[model samples]
Target: MVWDDFAINNLAIYLLDKPNKDRKVALFVKGCDSRGVVRMLQDNQIKRENIYLIGIPCPGLKDPKTAARGYYKDAGSVPEAKKCEECRHPNPVLYDEILGTPVEEPQEKDRFAEVNELEKKSVDERYAYWTAQADKCLRCFACRNVCPACSCPDCMFDCTKPRWLDKEVSTEQNQFFHMIRVWHVADRCIECGECERVCPAGLPLMQLNRKLIKDINELFGPFEAGLDLEQRPPLTHYETGDPEELM
Candidate 1:
């Protein structure tokens, strides 16, 4: 089935929330979206027997607005999201069938190079950088909606009981939103770079996601989620003699 944002927007909730079809059949899996699939399987949300994945090589999806460079030789489709630039795992790890040749791992995977330097700046400078970015945010959930990892039945923000964020987009609220989202999906985020693609605000969102990606590699002795369909994620798995990084 050819599913995109348009198809999803029209029928996703209906299909996902209530599936009347007899055959579960197959579905597409973007690397990050695979987190949702694994999680759904983990929670018995779906049966493995009736499901298969068709994976595509991710090219660091872009935020449509951020994609517009004034004068570029070959600036293809301009994605509106910013997360595409810093995406680390552009290749799919697991697939029944792949569409094209695998994307070569970059020699320099330091997608966080800019963010690291920004972190070294004075506290006020760092604050200024983020503030500028947050100011640009219209509080659109494009990042959250497009992300395959954000599969909460009801998101924390929608919780009027706690009211994590106000309707007004505050700096604290913006940071809070990103922080909660990353932690929620940290263990399962496959670094597919989808969340960064739909953002109208050109925030350096990948810095946060890449931090986890790099940390998982360094701390956990190289872990890649969604590579092996049979295997669950390492962070969710446990053994007696695990690496000392956790301690």
Candidate 2:
């Protein structure tokens, strides 16, 4: 079947021109979404003064449109979102309120297993595979838009001056957009698997994210990006005698 624009976790920002007293304004943040929200709270961009947080237990939510019958047939009963595969934190560590029953931390799947196998393959094989996927690019920015961490009003691709990409189908341009965008969000990415779901090209985008998540875990320690508002992200923190970052 062809990919409809809404087939994935296609983000649609419902705009309200005027405020509504009866309407509740809340972001349906997944566990990872809460983390970025906590991070912003830590940074003081948003005030907790006029907000209502509705937290849900996520064994993981999938794109019902794209999820194959056997893969993710039931809510919270699926193979797992790629982010959940390596998820170090599953439940809310901090919240004023929560919804649904309390969820236990999930037994993590081996997130790096695929990346390790890919690494075993020769560089040429990896390049060929990635190029084939990248060549199918339609420049859909749905991946970035659906991500909770990617709530940016403007993205680099939206810029025109000295345009970073050709805006045309080309292996080089597509690869550059994918690689650069990944790197840009690497430190901040919550491994939510939103990108892979939104990819019209069906690129295994989670692999790139999982690799970074694994490296961060190994280098900095088992870090959960936005678990605690009081604590600093491992990437932004430093400790002496850390040898991993040197490698």
lDDT values, one for every candidate: 0.59, 0.62
Candidate 2: tens digits of C-alpha lDDT, residues 1-247: 3422222231112211124223545644446656656755554445555345556555644456445546544554544444555565655454567877767776766767888988898999988988988888777777766664554445677878857778687899989988877766665666657678667767788887767767777777776556767777665556776656624
Worst 10 residues of 1 by lDDT: 6-15
Tens-place lDDT digits, model 1, residues 20-89:
2235556555544555556556545456665666766654543324435444354454442334444455
Error of 1 at 175 (Å): 2.0
Q: What TM-scores do the predictions have?
A: 0.68, 0.74
Cα RMSD (angstroms) for every candidate in the order listed: 5.1, 5.8
Model 2 weakest 10-residue run by lDDT: 9-18
Give me the runs in candidate 2 sitting further than 4 Å from their true place. Answer: 1-24, 39-45, 67-88, 234-247
Error of 1 at 118 (Å): 2.8
